[model samples]
Target: MTNAEPPAPRTVVPIEPSLLIAEAFNQAQVTALRHSVTSCSHAAGLTGQRLDDFVLAVNELITNAVRHGGGQGRLRLWRRPGELICEVADHGQGISVRRLSERARPAPDTAGGWGLWLARELSDTMAVETGEAGTIVRITAALAAQPVTRPADS
Candidate 1:
């Protein structure tokens, strides 16, 4: 007999199918996923400066998923009332939260190290879920209330 505890239950977030984009991204499929994410974002009514910001932030995360996240992952996008949500998940070793924020900004000459930081800065809110099995980053950008325009009267 030996002292041992039961394994903990997993905490992977379930993707909402109603608004899901790409279910998985591989080395050859990243471009398609990017297009899907942007198209969904556009259809969700993201536009102008806010639209560009959201795309940039999400692109960084996708790049990280390809370069660092075992060269494959998943991407999803959806609309939530006043916000647009994007989620990227990878089946690779996780990075600690502390390490994720080590630098405020990378040096100009530095080859890289700015993906996660930029995501947090650009998105309205971001959450990170990581473990030995995988990592998922969910980011939200508040949708600017579209201006109501009325027809001009003679």
Candidate 2:
């Protein structure tokens, strides 16, 4: 047998907006999730601006799931170490980003292409996993006691 490395320890974090249920596609569910995240972050000492960023990224991911993932999905939000993480899962057709982008890149006239792109850009880290069970898009943003600063500040 060959030598194998042990798995790294998982990061433990506070779970606030845990396992949100989206029974049907609607504007209210999206709004509720956004508010829930921002409120949780703010209560945990995360500032308004930083909360806004988290909300934006989370909304984009969630919206994409509801709109593209057959009009329904599930979401989970938690704080991991120094970051806030949001995971949205859908039980519909999975996305193939490679083929979709290569076939016809969403242009200015496109409707929903910008959501995922914006989510990835706003969050510190973004990843997507799709399988027969569902598609889950994970987004993370660094939280700070104060508002986030631009890199140019240094």
Candidate 3:
């Protein structure tokens, strides 16, 4: 048999969900964007503390994009069954490995470095994809509280 070339590596792309809001933003638009996200998230069934936490998490992502990811970015918001999702993408240098790996609370004395950490803490789940070209952060919050299940004592 003739020598065969190795197969190309597969790239896994997440399927696009139906979008509720999609917009481009810059420093001047941060406030308006946050308001829009808040409205959309509320309409998607999040309420009270969950709504507030989700809005705060999204704000952090947007602010980070402005401050660290080149002053402008794109945002997308959507819903999937029981969860609401928001994604922010910016074209700037990628995040360092050290920053990505550190998930602890920042020291109270620290002046900055709270955005990503706060986003992670506030959302039900958070994911980031970054490289020299840009960075994308996606955060999800549940629309309703999930029940906690306990195992039977044997």
Candidate 4:
């Protein structure tokens, strides 16, 4: 057989959403998050309303991983269906759904649990999958095809 190489499994394509590549460190994670959003916006041709949704979701997911996903992780985002899907994978011990639900409840007069809370609010669907590889928290936010209009016209 010839020595031709096979296609790469994890190919980074032009995503309408952002993808972050960084260590498990907090500072790096933060910078990666911001860059991911900008990249996504630019790649997806996002503007105005789309930008708002993407920025909000990106911040929430990145913040959550930094605080709860054990320290370091990798983030990947893409346009799936009509929604933006983000996957934040970390090499932490992993978290239970029950624990996540409890922690997601923000305390009164405090901003601490707000990341998870905001993630849940902005995302149409959220789920956690843990294994020997690590834990990957997936978050998805729906995107409107066109700018939503207020009522008034018949």
lDDT of 1 by residue, 1-154 (tens): 9778888998986566448575787779867777777788888888887888888888888888888889988887877768889999998888777867574777878788889888888889989998888789999988878888999998
Best by TM-score: 3
Off by over 4 Å in 2: 1-28, 99-106, 145-154
Candidate 3 residue-wise lDDT, 10-121, digit = tens:
9986687768999999999999999999999988889899899999999999999999999999999998878999999999898999999998899999988999999999
Per-residue alpha-carbon lDDT of model 2 for 1-154, expressed as tens digits? 8788889899886454443333343445888777876777676556766667767887887788877786777777676556777778888678776733543435987765777777777788888888666688888878664566778845
lDDT of 1: 0.83
lDDT by residue for model 4 (49-142), tens: 5566656766776666667666666777677546667777777676666667574457788857676666666666778787656677777667
Candidates in descending lDDT order: 3, 1, 2, 4
For residue 115, model 3's alpha carbon misses the true position, in angstroms, by: 0.2
TM-score of 4: 0.62
Candidate 2 lDDT (Cα, 0 to 1): 0.71
Candidate 3: segments with Cα more than 4 A from true spot: 1-16, 145-154
Root-mean-square deviation of Cα positions for candidate 1 versus the true structure, in angstroms? 12.2
lDDT for position 1 in model 2:
85
Cα lDDT, all candidates: 0.83, 0.71, 0.94, 0.66
Q: What is every candidate's alpha-carbon RMSD to the true fold? A: 12.2, 9.9, 10.1, 9.2
